[model samples]
Target: MTNPVKGPTGRVPGWVKVVGSVVLLLAVLFAGLRLSVLPGLKDLFGTETRDRSGPALLESIQDISRYEAASGNFQVVVDLEKDAKFLPDAVRGSRTLYVGAGTVDAYVDLGALDGDDVRVDDDRTSATLRLPHARLGTPALDPERSYAVSKQRGLLDRLGDLFSDNPHSEQAVQKLAVRHIGDAAKESGLTGRAESNTTEMLENLLRSLGFKEVRVTYGD
Candidate 1:
């Protein structure tokens, strides 16, 4: 006869066998659930699948039309210190000083190119492309780089700040920063550089497509 299984108390281990079986069953269930949900887990994690290559794979020319050629970045700093007096000659006033930094992007817009704007030689050896003027996009204020340096309020002005929910002085400073940065970008010749860069880009692209010569020009 086979020897009987002896537990710690010298009897058959009925409870231990049941606990082991339960643990094994739970593990198998967990593995099965994991395998079933594996496919959709990527979506839950915000991972996307797509083709990032150029639009040359499109079937027709209409699908691959507009291109934004960003060519220049302008960095600007603006400083302002102003005192606003409520009364004509009163000494009480609010004084604020702020410094802001931002970047402006210059790019060439090519969305309106028509057949008349592009001409390719019959032999595909040369091409001419007329593009629109280079324009400055909106200035982006870098919040992390911009701040109010100092703020001073007179006796009367300090009382107003205690109950005011809006930060009027800070807002004014930000507006001034944007206006000055825009003006600086225009005076810096960044737009001209953008135009040159965009021309060079198109020339290189055309050359890749077997073009021996490429002429790019800007139109009003």
Candidate 2:
């Protein structure tokens, strides 16, 4: 009463059955292996994420689309991030703006935050700016005089960056450092806000010194 499904012989043919079972088992093992390994392939369908801190290749920048301007002031739109974009098809391509483009010696008077980041009345070429003031509080830095905020670390970072063939590597490092330390840092003595303003001032000063089409915002 051996099953006829076993093959032409009354008893299952050893070779045929073994071959059939082995094929079936191999198929199953392959399927199981594929199932076990499949989820990892899900991420592969997508490409790796990219960061464009500075200008991109193949693409060009023109007409830096005027992202933000403080209404009628000095027409200021500062992009704190390096990837600020522009019209892609212009004759002149994308150029990046960076820090160290100005003197870190920008002097903040211990006056008041008159909300005067920049002020322009009308038909005036030379505008006035009342940048944020600092008291340095009880351990006060003198109001009439100037004080250095001491971004010397930033300077050293830039120096290292200069020697490196790729400046973006430093920026990448900065981005990482910002991610790790940024939270506690904001609440710490040096608010990232202050650092940001400093950067903005540096850019604006350079803009006045004649860097065209500047912007200041968080990286979009």
Candidate 3:
């Protein structure tokens, strides 16, 4: 009988092993690049190195009502103009007209209240409460409605603006317009009106709570 022929054992070739190593190295490098660029990828893949939500988680459950009070909204329109001159009037640089529409808030804070500020008359028939005075908050300019009504820039003005740190001079003018709106709202008795409205509101609320008489006053 002829000797049985031996078949070659099945095994991966050396070239195949080298190719597999290169592919694995490339895959590891690509993964490292992605992880470096996208820090959130680690969290998405459940490989976050550390927890960073401690403070945010704690703040999420805290109450925010301890700092607020009654607020009233007032709409105001402010017209303002500013002129910057590099030379004589003949060489006027820029004259800008800004029209700003702002919403001003007037608030009455109750955070300063104490037990003595609220007094109940004998027999509990009436209650008198003294509250802090109403004050005006900053005016929030409406980006949609507030804009540069007109801007006239002379040759020098345009030339200087090209190199100035603040290229847009209208922005500063718009800020001034907003400030004027807040000032105008305050001067228009807006805060006093807010105080009156707040007092009336609180009086009605207290009356609804079975108080025969409710007197609400504001302190200086």
Regions of model 1 farther than 4 Å from truth: 1-91, 167-169
User: How do all models score by TM-score?
Assistant: 0.63, 0.17, 0.59
Model 2 per-residue lDDT tens digits across residues 1-220:
6575675456677887789999999999997677668997645554687896987577665542111211110111112332224523232222232221111111334233344455544544444444443212111112223222222233444566678787554343233333333333323444334435655765687568655544432310
RMSD of each: 20.0, 22.5, 17.1
* Alpha-carbon local distance difference test for all models: 0.74, 0.40, 0.71
Candidate 3 achieves a global lDDT of 0.71
| RMSD, candidate 2, Å | 22.5
The TM-score, computed over Cα atoms with residue i paired to residue i, of candidate 1 is 0.63
In angstroms, give how far residue 78 of model 2 lies from its true place. 37
* Overall local distance difference test of candidate 2: 0.40
Q: Return the candidate ranking by lDDT, descending.
A: 1, 3, 2
> After TM-score superposition, what is the CA distance of residue 202 in candidate 2 from its true location, in Å?
4.8
Ten-residue segment with the worst summed lDDT in candidate 1? 63-72
Cα shift from native, residue 93, model 3 (Å) = 0.3
* Separate clash counts for every candidate: 0, 10, 0
